[model samples]
Target: MCCALAVPLPVGTAAAIDDQQFNELKDLVTKLGQKIEKQDLRIEQLEKTHAQDAQVHAQDQKTHEQDQRKIQELQQKLEETQQAVSNVQTAAIAVPVEPLPRVPLDEATVNHNFSILGDAEFQYAKTSGQHGTFLFADFAPIFLYRGGEKVLFEAGFDFGLQNNAPNSPGATTTINLSFAQLDYLMNDYVTLVAGDMVLPLGTYSERTAGWLNKIPDDPLPRDLLPGAGVGAQLRGAVPLGESGKLINYSVWGVNGASSADGTGNADQLDLGGNVGLRSDNAVANLHGKPSGGARVGWFMPFKPHYDLELGLSGQSGEWDNAGQHLWSAGVLDASLHLGSTVEVKGEYIRSCYGSDDHGNVRPEGWWLQASYKLVGLNLDWPVINNLELVNRYDSIHDGLGTRTRRYTLGYIYYFSNTLLFEGGYEFLHSNDPTQKDQLIFQLSYGF
Candidate 1:
């Protein structure tokens, strides 16, 4: 039991207080005491609420820490996986591409940092209702070397023989070294190239090789570009967004073309000039000048298989001594892919040759190609599952009041990853009213 003690008031104050006033004062004190009790209860409720909030905050912090740790673990695992894959790839590329007998593909004894890849092709082509010629057309060997993570070198050569006389033993054999270039990886965004480099003038000269090209005949006025040139180049790839938007670009200064330089990949100047040309390879230097060229491309890829690419290229330079062959050219290319089953490709190019004799003769051409693959459709059948249907149209306006158009319907078969065979029936329509149709067949094997 507890007891409280109170001090007594003064005798005069107690006498002055009337009974009614005393009763009112007691009631007022009782109200004040009740308010104090209510305030204390409210303070206790607030303290409980604050304690609950602290517990919730602590729980949230623990969850966030756990998530961070998981992310770090996943990052470490991904890095380890990537490093393992790189090591395996490096070990494989060090072996010779074509090793000797009894040497397992995975355990070849030879160890080299360089490897070789090549394509062998044969073709038969002729005008419709005319004589056709068969020949072993091309042997292209590509050399690849990786000097370091940031340095690379590649070179390629094409050797072919054309037989014009089927009844005779004479055949014209042609051999050309396409490119011998050294690449220095400047950074993620730029690369430097020197030596006899492939010109980045158009999409075809760089991408359409014997191993992977879809068609046998190139578009008219294919001479709009040089196959290779002596030059230095700056090229790079630009990342546009995470959704697979990208841009690629190249710019270079090279030995320009002259009137003597024929069409694209057909440089006769390299053969005739005896200026100590190594292996009869010549670098053009018309009037002691260099040509400048640039190309830019935009690309986009979508999930589950769709892609689009568009590109533009242009070059300009002096061509001859008398300004008779000042040359300028431009090319535009586009490609579309859907699920690896269908593809549409096209290129348009215009070339201007300022010849003192022929004035400015601007030759323009465009070609469109489309292909559909049955293999990707999972036809489940035996023989024709790996077949593809292709079609192409080519139109030319030669500035010389001549126009030509060719339509081709073709079929391609893939016996294996290394073997491809294609055949086409072509229709040729010319303003000359004398041109005939043709049929073409080509086979290529890759190694």
Candidate 2:
């Protein structure tokens, strides 16, 4: 509008313009007014667009903050989840899981769990200046039961028939429970045994039981120790090296030696007594304290049929009903095998007992036995191969000025691994008049 006003009009027409020029000037002024109105509208529209753009920018900034908050929340949640997983893993490591139940055994397995094995013996005997006679018959059976994966139950019984007296019509029948025990395999090198177990005071009680003994009769010194005891024991063998050598050990606690007549009388001492009930209505094991014993042995094998074993064993405890006297015993045992058929074994036993009349008396004995299988000679003769030569020397002292010595020569004929015929002649010398030389024959079968 100012430019239009500033426009110079014709100088002569300034005071009194013509009608045609004045109308044209009015038209130009109206057009300029319309242009100014449009300019004002454009400026208002620009301001409105700027305000809308600023509002949009502020909204975008708010959205970006919300997104940042969401990401932070997600990261925190993830961290919490990871911690929870770690805690769960730790708990799993610390806790123990229950084992699965065992499957029941089938009928066949149950039947197979039980096994029976044993031996029977028939014997004839003759003593010096005495007529020969049938001595005794023995039937022994061993029962075995598999209780579990690591458990076993075993029992042995002996039934015997013998002459009661020198011309007596009545015969004697005796029954004995040798040993009944539960064995548990505690580990690779340990076993736990309980109940009436064979005492491991020496190797003879276990190794020479029943048909395993080549001799018809026990060694004289063996009567000094109890064969079995009611007790619990821990036993095992430990491998020594790679040469098949091992060390065996046993530790036991039991009702040991006790007075037969509840007295500390030396003459009335009984090795196989102290069981069941006494005359006084007292239970067995008259002594208040149980006895303790142990055996340790080393067995070394150089080759097949070539080996040596040495063992030391002992026991000690009170014996009398009053528990005033103590009894103790020690044993040293050794055995050697040479080649396939020559074997030698021996035992030295020493014992002491406190008696009221005798104070302390010491009894000692030793025995040595040897056998040679003729098959070891590589003889082509079958008869000779089936025959084995045996010899033994045994001595004993009763610790009361009574002593005995014996020498035995014997032969064993083996029909099979489980059947044998054994015969022997003994030469005996003794301070006691009752002991004399004897002849013995035995027919033994093991199944």
Candidate 3:
């Protein structure tokens, strides 16, 4: 085995098996192993890189979605805010402003003029004492106006006709100037009225003289208490306090007996005055609420129960043959209102002529009346809107004549506050042969 091993080896084969070949083989094997390990490491690293990249991309996508949602929400909020602002702007432009108060008419530029307003009333009567129908018409046109500061013109005409007789001279149709006067408003607190002016004895004679029968008609003392005569009057209001306390006064100088019916001399002068007080919560507290006032008066002619007048007069004009007579008269009036629906009014008056005169002269006489009103009644849709019912009672007593009592029932239907239809029935009773009971109807229009 030793000889074979020594002689049998090939030269190239032996040389190929030297140290360099062995070393080269070993190096190549090691390099191949290292390459395999490096390839495995590279693959693992690639997987880890891919996973990190995916996680990062997922996080970025989530952040982008959140940002998108936030942007959408902000856009929606902005849109809603713009809509609210737009609505506010629209409302601001839609509302309307209020108007200012109106100015009063200038009295300096005022025109003084006369106006005529009259109505004819017909009566059908069948009384216990008499049975007859009377047709009568009253035509009265008054002239009144404010002329500057010192001069005011007032005049009126009265025409009464009775249809009782066809051929007979119709009951001496009396035509006369009910009132003719020139008044001077001396100042805000005083005035002077002369010529045929209203006597300041009664409330009806002075306060309501301008519009007769526009309210209820007055009789006896109210109708004949020296209504118009040659007189001078002073009227004004005196304030007692800033609480709206006031004293209203009217003083007049009138022809006593000679001024009767505007036929006697304008010689003797009678004096009269009225005092009143007024107070209102509207003025006291400045709240513009409703208010009220009252008045009392005195006259030179002394009449019983008449606090207004006390006097003595001697006539020398037309009653020369007739003996002199003492005359007296007075009045008391009051008015009050509650809210818009209720009102209260009252008045009394008396006049007397001394017993020295013949049977023609009479004792004191007086009359009184009152009324109430209710407003707004709803019926159906629009059938009954504004409606009111009124009831009134009146009585008069004159010493020379009988006592008269009257009852009135009335209704008013209003198309508006200013326009309405008034209808009523009046029942009368008297103890005089010449006077008879009657039923009356009237239609009134006013503005």
TM-score of each: 0.68, 0.74, 0.53
* lDDT order of candidates, top first: 2, 1, 3
- Candidates, ranked, TM-score: 2, 1, 3
What is candidate 3's TM-score against the reference?
0.53
Across residues 1-447, which tens digit of lDDT does each residue of candidate 2 receive?
989999887877765667778899999999999999999999999999999999999999999999999999999999999999999999998999888998876544665789999999998999888998885568999999987778899999999886679977987899999999999999999999999899988899999867788888889998889999888999999999899999999999888888777889887666656655677797766778988999999999999989999999999888887888888999999999998789999999999999999999999999999999999888799999999999999999979998999999999999998899999999999989999889999999999
lDDT of each: 0.79, 0.90, 0.51
Clashing pairs in 1: 128-437, 223-264
Winner by lDDT between candidate 3 and candidate 1? 1
Indicate whether candidate 1 or candidate 2 has the larger TM-score.
Answer: 2
Model 1: CA > 4 A from native: 1-111, 164-169, 261-284, 323-325, 432-435
Backbone clashes counted, model 3: 12
- Indicate the worst ten consecutive residues by lDDT in candidate 2: 268-277
Indicate the worst ten consecutive residues by lDDT in candidate 3.
285-294
Comparing 2 and 3 on TM-score, the stronger one? 2
Q: Where does candidate 1 have its weakest 10-residue lDDT segment?
A: 265-274
